[model samples]
Target: MNQQPVEGFSKLSKQRKIDWLIKEYLSDDRSYEQILQQYWNGDAILQKLHEEFSENTISNFYMPYGIAPNFLIDGKLLALPMAVEESSVVAAASKAAKFWIDKGGFKTTIINTKKLGHTHFIINVEPHKLQHFFNFKLKKRLFEATEEITKNMRNRGGGILNIRLIDKTADLENYFQLKASFDTVDSMGANFINSCLEQFGKTLTEEVAKDETFTPEEKDSLQIVMNILSNFTPDCIVRAEVSCKIEDLKDDSGISNEEFATKFKRAVTIAEIEPFRATTHNKGIMNGVDAVVIATGNDFRATEACAHAYAAKDGKYTSLTHCTIDGGVFRFWIDLPISVGVVGGLTNLHPLVKFSLALLGKPSAQELMSILAVSGLAQNFAAIRSLVTTGIQKGHMKMHLLNILNQLGATEEEKNHFVTYFKDKTVTHHEVISQFNSLRAQ
Candidate 1:
């Protein structure tokens, strides 16, 4: 469809944008206007606050916020809040949490907590000279120059940790990188790290211009390309694990414990060896990770990017998790580079986010990383257990039945009837419509 740009779309009032959208796209359908209003907050103050969250606010989008309790991580029981619209994700995590609670639950360890940023520049100078320029004296001077920016972060026990010069001339002529590491403490630190990088870029340019060691060509060639924090934080990593004896792996799937363990391990092996399978495997893990991350008002996009990148760090895409049965003990675990924050962003501003953090006992950044990793591990375990046993559709379809019923506009009575009707039957959209039609006919 051909469309014309609406000038000053963002400057329009909230209602004005809605009116424009309805006129242009809805063809003057008044029903959508009501639908949009239906999701608005009942309180005027809350609704106004929500409108300010973004530009051109039309309506509030909502996802089911659920809690998965009995997560005994590091001897602490926690009820993790998860915001997701997927049918079976919360159910799967809850089931895994209960199953592992008796099996010593989950153990988590923080491997590293340093975030990364880069300052890319081009300098037509010898590699030795470039290396010498980033020497101890200059590095100290650079850190000192950013003291004004780093002062607050340092007071909070987080600041610029290290600055190193990286030679990338092999890829592009005269290309070099000024890579930095930071301890952001409790915050996600995107803005802080970027601010520091910009300051560093300015300092580098000024310092090079003043140095008598560089010719005009070398000084002029020092052009900063960009300064930004990297979402691929390999150094910010955590590990979560759950282990139990192979003989203890019993369930209603009718598979023997030993056979189940063997099959589970095999499924993980396939994900490890096959990129196609690994992608979906990792996505299942993210279902749990992202839910908790979003619930706590953290950046799920950055967390997901870092995780997928870490999965491919071995030069081939593979699962973010691993499983093994050794000495009659079955163990499933994941080592992932997950960067999340307990403070900053929407954690304090959003009401639901604050509630979710409070529900988590207000963990530190490191503790939040552990909780998120465990959530992913739990979700992966539940998914693989289903995949190797009764197949994923049985339980998923059962949970998805409500969505189908709701879509058909089934009455509460009819929905109640079908809920029991499809308990042991496979659910399909066609079957649901057929049943709804049959019920209506009667």
Candidate 2:
């Protein structure tokens, strides 16, 4: 491998960068160049827009944008778009949607929609003195100072909800946090919350400088570390659940409904107590969550980080969802904190996102939260049901059969024949390749 660095790489034209990359690293491979070109949108304008989505854009990387229809969420049918490369995710979600639709659908409720931001600072002043200064008068003044920044949000009935002082001397010397909560309404409010916090930080610095109760040394010790919004939004939570009679859970797998529910509940309990299981357990939940989040043009990374942080909020990693059978009814639900927005970022910029929102009837932020949470819950149920019944691979590997066939370069006839052949038999990569090779020999 050559270790030489290419100077002015970012300044190179798009084609130049592509040329340089191919010549430098790919040994001038035209096939790889063609592969990149093959995925570019035929429309030049759209392709350019995609290229500009980020810097040094050589080409577009794509995931299959699929639709999982028949989601009966909150008494409405929705077709959710999922952007994922995995084989069985969309299939499993679709199965879950269809199963739950006949079981009275998924019910969801938004517990709250308040996002959080903080202005972290260190102060050498007495704790009591700082608390007294953060009283009603100072708090009101702080809110008033950010009025310009929050005016539009305020007019829309969303703005700074509360501000409080948190003492952290036990954790660090002279450390304190000005925790602020906001109602961003339909937008994720990252920029809005950050702007407000920065303004608050400036106001706090000025106010502390002028406070007669604070000596010169104390004023100098008051230092702002950072001001930013928190993705771990515990207050912005939603609950989504599905319930049915245990008898209604009967399936073609020959497992009794009672036994099915018991195994499912036990599976959830193991995730709750075991850290290793909980990591993968929550990842399965996010496969559903991140897909919907990406489809709707929300920040999937932020949502993922927040959801996992919420999972470990109890100081031990655990499941984000729970299953229970009560009074002859089998219920599964997830109460997780997910911060998402429907009005900003890529939601407004991407064409597919607009379509995805329209497919969901253009839900508000709270409604989007409910729908996302339900997607996770439904995915979990489908997974647990599969695990407890015929085992995970029966369905997963079946869904994966197409990928194997395609990879083996099976023609349409071979694919159709082998798809039917593998329907009743187990499928593996080696088996598919061997069968394909044998068929080709014939």
The prediction achieving the highest TM-score against the true structure is 1
Off by over 4 Å in 1: none
All candidates' TM-scores? Answer: 0.97, 0.97
Native-referenced Cα lDDT, model 2? 0.90
Q: Give the alpha carbon lDDT tens digit for every residue of 1-442 in model 2.
A: 4746899999999889888888888877878888888888999998887877789888888889999999999889998889899889998999999988888899998899989999999999899989999994568889899999999999998999999999999999999999999999999999999999999899999999998989999999989999999998998999999899998986767878888889889999999999999998889899999999988988888999999999988899899999889999998899979999899888887888999998889999999999899888878888888887888988998888889888877789988999899989988878888888888898
Off by over 4 Å in 2: none
Model 1, span 186-224: residue lDDT tens:
999999999999988998999999999999988988899
Q: Lowest-scoring 10 consecutive residues by lDDT in candidate 1?
A: 133-142
Q: What is the lDDT, from 0 to 100, of the residue 335 in candidate 1?
A: 95
Candidate 1 clashing pairs, residues 3+ apart or interchain: none
